[model samples]
Target: MSVIVLDKLTKDFKNGRGVFDVSISVKRGECYGFLGPNGAGKSTTMRHLMGFYQPQSGSATIDGLNCWRDQKQLQSKIGYLPGEIAFPVDMTGKNYIRMIAKMRGMKDLSYEKELEDFFEINPASELRRMSKGMKQKVGIILAFMHKPELLLLDEPSSGLDPLMQSKFIELMERFKKAGTTILLSSHMFEEVERTCDRIGIIKNGRMIQEINATELRHSRLKTFELECEEEADLNKLLVQFPKMLYDRQTRIVRISVPDSRINELIAALSVCRLRYLKEEKHTLEEYFMQFYGGKSNV
Candidate 1:
C-alpha cells in the first residue's frame, strides 16, 4: 500500500516558484528521497504532503486520507521537520518540548529523553540563545519522539555537523527497520544515498529523474581512466571511442562503458600502446552531477 501519494499535485505562485505537476507515491515502510537543489520544489512538494498548502491541481494523500481536507488527523500521525525552523525565542527548548508533548496528549517522555541524550542536546537553554545546530537537534528529537509511522523531513540535517549528520542517518536506518514510512527531502547526495530505497530528483518545479537505489548501486556502467604510452595511442583510442574525454597534453583518456561493452573497451585499448588502465570509483554525487552539467553545487 502507498502510505503517501501526490498525484500531479501542483501549487503555482505568482513569482513562478512553486511545484508544478509533481507526482510521487511512497509505499508503506519505504523511504523515498526527494533529491534536488535548494529551490527545486522539494520543499514545496513536502509542504503539500504536510497539508500546509492546498494543491492548485490534483491531490495529496497519506494512507488514503486527503492531505488538505484531513490535515487535523494527519498532523497527529506524522513526524515532520520543516526546512526552516521557527520557534518562540523566549521559550526554552525543554518547555517547548513539554508544550508539544502536552498538546499531543503524550504523558511519557522516555523516548524523548533518549533522543536528547543520543544527540547530546542540552535543551535547558532558551530557543533564542541556542545555536542553529542545537535547535536542529531539538527539532529532530521532537519529530522522532512520538514514533509516528509516517515521517516527512525536509533538510533535516541542514544545521548538523558531520558527526551529527551521521547520527541522523543512523536514526533514519533505525526508523526504517521499525517499519516507518519516510519522505526525506534534501540536496545532499550522500544522505539520500545512505537512507533511501528510491530517489526522485526535481528541478525547476518538475521531477527530472527517478533512480532505484539498488539498481544504481549494482549498475554495470563503469568509468575507466587510461594513460597512453604515446600521443598517437590516445588518438587511436579516441577514434574507437569518440565520446571518450582525451587530454592530448597528458595522453590520458576517460571513458565509461557498460559490462556488456568491456570486451569492446579491451579490444580498443589493446590496439593502442597503453601505459596503464585504472578503474575509477563512481559515486551517487557524480551521477547526479550529470543532470546539472557537471555542477556539484546542486
Candidate 2:
C-alpha cells in the first residue's frame, strides 16, 4: 500500500511558481528519493506533503489521511527533518532533544543514549557552539528518537562529515529493515543513488520522470568511442543515430545509445580495425542532466 500519495498536487505562490500538477506515490518500507536542482520545486513539494503549506489545488495524503486537513494526526505518525536546522542557540543539545521528545508526548529517554552513541553527539554542547555538522546530528536524533512510522528528510546530510554521512546511510538501512517508510529529498545525486529505491526527477515544477534505480542503471545511455581504419562515414552514421555527437578530424567519435542497440553497434564495429571501444554508462548525475537540460554546478 502507498504510504504517501500526491494526486495532481498544485501549490502556487504569490510569484506564481511551485509544484505544478505534481502526482506521485511512495510505498511502505521504501525509500523514495525526490531529486531536482535548486529552484526546481523540490522544497515546495516537500512542504505540501508535510502540511507546512497548503496546495492551491489538488490533494496530498499520508496513509489515506488528507495532508492539509488531518495534519495534526499525520504529525504524530511521521518525523520531519527540514533542509535548514533552526534552533534556540541558548539550549544545550540534550535539552533541545528532550524538549522535542516532550512535545511529541514521548516520555522515554532510552532512545537518547542509543542516538548519542551512534551519532557521537555531545549532549552538553550548546547549540551556538556546535559545528554545522554537529547541529545536523542533533536534528537527525530528534527526527528518529520517537521511532515514527514514516520519516520525511529534506537534505538530511547537508552538513555532516564523510564519516558521519556513511553512518547516516547505515542508519537509514536499519530504518528500512524495521519497516519504516522514508521520503528523502535532495540535490545530491550520489547520496540518492546510494540510498533510494526509486527516484523522481522534477524540472520547472513538473515531474519529468520516475524510475527504479536498478532499471535506470540498466537502461542508462552508454557512450562509445570508435576509431575506424580510415576516415569514417560520419554523415551516414549521423543519420542512423541522430543523437550521436562526433568529431571526424581527430578520428574520435562519441555517441550515447540505448542498451538495446549496444549489441548491434558492437557487431558493426567488429568489422573495422577498432583501436578502442569503451562503454560509458550513465550515472545518477547524467540521468538527472537528461531532464534538466544539463548538469548545473549547484
Candidate 3:
C-alpha cells in the first residue's frame, strides 16, 4: 500500500521558481530515490512532505493523514533529515539527543548508544566544536534513534567521509530489511542506485522521468566505443547508425546496441578497419546526464 502520496503537489515561490504539478507515491517498505540538482525543487517537495511548507495547490499525505494539517500528530511516525542542519551551539551532542529523546518520551539509551558506536560518533562532544561530519552524525542519530515508520532523508550523507558514507549505506540496508519505508532525496547517483527500488528524476521543479532501479540494473542496452583505423570507418558507422554519438577529434563512434543486436553490430564493424572495439558500462550517472543534455550545472 502507498504510505506516502502527493497529488498534483505544487508550491510557487515569488521568484517564479517552485515545484509544479509534482506527484509521487512511496509504498511501505520501499525506498524511493528523489533525484535532482540544487534549485530543482527537490528540497521544496521534501518540505511539503514534512509539512514544513504549505502547498499552493494539491496535497501531500502520509498514511492517509494530511501532511500539513496533521503534521504535529504525524511527527512521531516519521524521521526526517533536512538538507541543512542547525544545532544549539551551547549544548553538547549528547545533551541534545537526550533532550529530543525525552520529548519523545524515550527512556532507553541502548539504541542511541548503539547508533553512536556504529557511526563512530561521540555525542558528548560540544556541538560548536564538532566538525561538519560529526554534526552530520549527530543529525543521523537524532533521526534514527526513535526508528519511526517512515524516513525522509535529504542528502543524508552530505558531510560524511567515504568510510562514513559506506557505513550510512549499510545502515540504510538494515532499515530496508526491517521493512522501513524511506524517501531519499540526493544528487549523488551511486547511493540512490544502490539503495532505492525506484527513482523519480526531477528537474526545474518538474518530474521528467520515473524508473524502476531493477530495470536499469539489468538493462539489455549496451554502449560500444569503437575507434577507427581510418576516418572512413568512423563515417561508415555513423551513417549506418544514425543514433551513434561520434567524436571527430578521437575518430571514434559510440553506439548503444541491445544484447540481441550485438551480433549484428559485430558483423557491421567487421567490414570496417577498426583500431579497437570496447564495450562501455552504462552508469546511472550517464543515464541522468542524458536528461540534462549530457552536461550538468551541479
Candidate 4:
C-alpha cells in the first residue's frame, strides 16, 4: 500500500517558484529519493506534506489522512527533518530534545541515546554555542527518536562530515530494512543512490522524471572505454560502430553496447589491437544530467 501520496500537488508561489502539478507516491517500506538543485521546490513539496502550507491545487496525504486537515494527528506519526533548522539559542541540545519529547509525551529515550552514540555527538551544549554539524546531529536524533513509520528528511546529512554522512546512509538502510517509508530530499547523489529504491527529479518546480534506482544501477546499456594500441586500430573499430565516441589524440574510444550486442562488440574488438578495455557503469547522476541540461547542479 502507498504510505504517502502527492496527487497533482501544485503550490504556485508566482513566477514559477513553487511545485507545480507534482505527483508522486511512496509505497510502504519504500525509500523515495527526491532529487533537484537548490530552489527546485523539493522543500516546498515537503512543507505541504508537513501541513505547513496548503496547496493551491491538488492534495497531499499520508496513510489516507489529508495533510492539511489532519496535520495535528499526523505530527506524532511522522519523523521530519527540515532543510533548514531553527534552534532555540537559550536551550541546550539535551533540553531542546527533552522539550520536543515532552510535547510528544515520550517517556523512553533509549533509542535517542543510541542515535547520539552512533552520531558521536554530545548534545549537552547550548544551541547558540553548538557548531552547524552539532546542531545537525541533534536534528537527526529528533527525527529518529520516535521511530515513526514514515520519515520526511530534507538534506538530512547537510552539515555532516564524510564519516557522518556514510553513517547516515547506513542508518537509512537500517530503517528501510525495518519497513520504514521515507521521502528523502537530498543534494548528495551518493547517499540517494545508495539508499533509495526509486527517485524523482524535479526541475523548475515540476517533477520532470521518475525512475527506478535498480534499473539505473544495473542498466542493460553498458559503456565500454577502449584504448587502442594504434590510431588505425581505433579508426577500424569506429568504422564498425560509427556512433562510438572517441578521443583521437588518446586513441581511446567509448561505445555504449547493449547486452544482446555484447558478442557483436567482442567480435568487432577482436579484430582491433586494444591496449585496455573497461565497462563504465551507468550512475543515477548521469541519467539525472539529461534533465538538468548536462550539468550536475545538484
lDDT by residue (tens digit), candidate 3, 1-298: 9999999999988676999999899999999999886788888998998999999999999999999999998999888998998899899999999999999989888999999999988878899999999999999999999988899999999999999998999999999999999999987787887899999988888888899998877775899988888888888787778899988888888899877778888988999988888989667897787666536433
What does candidate 4's lDDT look like per residue over 1-298, in tens digits? 9989999999888886898899999999999999887788999999999999998999999999999999999989899999999988799999999999999999999999999999999899999899999999999999999999999999999999999999999999999999999999998889999999999999888887888998766655889998998988887887888999999998889999877788999998998888899989666677666666746434
How big is the positional error of residue 149 in model 1, measured in Å on the Cα after superposition?
A: 0.4
Per-residue lDDT of candidate 2, residues 60-153 (tens digit): 9999999988999899889899888789979999888888888899988798779889988777889999989988999999889899899999
Task: Point out the higher-scoring one by TM-score: 2 or 3.
Answer: 3
By lDDT, the candidates rank as 4, 3, 1, 2
Candidate 1 pairs with clashing backbones: none
- List the global CA lDDT of all models: 0.89, 0.83, 0.89, 0.91
Model 4 ranges with Cα > 4 A deviation: 220-282, 294-298
* CA RMSD of all predictions: 5.0, 5.6, 5.3, 3.9
TM-score of 2: 0.77
Off by over 4 Å in 2: 220-282, 294-298
Best by TM-score: 4
On lDDT, the candidate that comes out on top is 4
| Local accuracy of candidate 1 as per-residue lDDT tens digits, 156-191 | 999899999999999999999999999998877888
The total of clashing pairs for model 3 equals: 0
